[model samples]
Target: MRTQFGSPIDYFLELGADTIHMNELLGKPLHMKYVGQQCLNCGKDRKIYRMGHCYNCFYELPQTADWVIRPELSKAHLDIEDRDLAYEKDVQLQPHIVYLALSSDVKVGVTRKTQVPTRWIDQGANSALEIVEAPNRYLAGIAEVALKQFVADKTNWRQMLKNEVAQEDLFEFRAKLSQHIPEEVRPYFLSEKSDKWDLDFPVQKYPAKIKSLNLTKTPEFSEKLAGIKGQYLIFEDDTVFNVRGNEGTVVEIFIS
Candidate 1:
């Protein structure tokens, strides 16, 4: 049959068409039906496509998986911060994560808004994702820890710190973070002379064995996140990406 373009040639020869259409040249192009399927998580009947996941399931998956592995494009969110950190300026800012992928391996890191990409690139991470949209610095740090657990690579945690700390604040938290790591990984993290601020919680080393944490297995207690049903994703480190929408946090939500 003649195509919509009216080329008068076989439609099957096109890039994505089937040869069967050529066999019956006079027949109309086949019309497929759309069947709704139940959500994998909540068993709610819904439409599913591509890999048994509905549209809602798709976006919930990490958009940064590739972006984190390459950080240059991701640094637009922090151009202003870069200037501040380089000038040794004192700025009280919320923390964010520099999600990294080193030749396909995952790394999770924390930084003040300005120093994140600079810090990641210095740590041998050629690619990175900056989670600049988090609620606060502490929660951003928590997201970093979660991402590290998800990626499940301490080597990614090889170099990370809560920057913008004063000498007294550094003195207070250094003893805590130092207890967990060797002296080698501590130097790059020392706060600048004019910097002031600190982590409320000491950087806790995530257990190596628990790298397989899956959000699918964790029960959902929050009502807001319930709409995010039947949608699950496994990050580079195998941690299941859970849907936890904090106040003012923008989650690219999915519903199936």
Candidate 2:
């Protein structure tokens, strides 16, 4: 799903050369057939090991290095290479942001500065504000490590999907968390007097209870599309499918 920041977020689903405006598909009858898993990186039929990559790809690819998951472990900025030095420099030697987001709960996370609102939307955050903007992923990651002791790093996807989030002020959280920012990264702290970014998801109704649909168990099922938040395709029956989680999986869809 592709998202653009707006009063109400705009969502688009791209399939091959086709682009489907997903907001228009809400409340419609939806049918899905799980085809099979294909490694998105190698473009071959293979079981997805993690993050849409096959087993070998997950371990061998420069993009899937350990530093990707744990930014503090990044070595590219130190002139050392992990998998591919050139690839690491391209991805790691750039601007990064450390942020506070209200997703299920107030959480601290890191992402590229260019991915500002997009990262927040993907996490299903109701509101978000940058605490610091570091020069590279390593700095951002270290900042995250420091802030983690005071705030959460993970989102409760279940509660977030149920729309059970409580109203909270990100700016307030940012103020409170600012004291914990590591000294090395404090110079990049955002004090530009900007308001928190808020997002509105397109949903007719939120589910009373959520049943996460695993395409492996029930590869074929049809349900009324209730709403979409994060990357999950919500069904009227409370069954939700996570499109991002099943990235390498091939599927056929029919809607009426």
Candidate number with greatest lDDT: 2
TM-score of 2: 0.97
The TM-score values for the models, in the order shown, are: 0.24, 0.97
Clashing pairs in 1: 41-230, 68-128, 68-129, 69-127, 70-127, 95-137, 151-237, 166-196
Of candidate 1, the 10-residue stretch with the lowest lDDT total is 221-230
Instruction: Estimate candidate 1's alpha-carbon lDDT, on a 0 to 1 scale.
Output: 0.31
The top-ranked prediction according to TM-score is 2
Q: In candidate 2, residue 185 scores what lDDT?
A: 88
Per-residue accuracy of model 2 over 1-256 as CA lDDT, tens digit each: 8998886788888776888888888989988998998998899999999999999999999998999989998989999999999999998999998888887988889999888799988888888888888899899999999989988999999989988886777777778888888888889989665967888988788888889898889989898888888888888999998989989988888889
Total colliding residue pairs, candidate 1? 8
- As a TM-score, model 1 comes out at 0.24
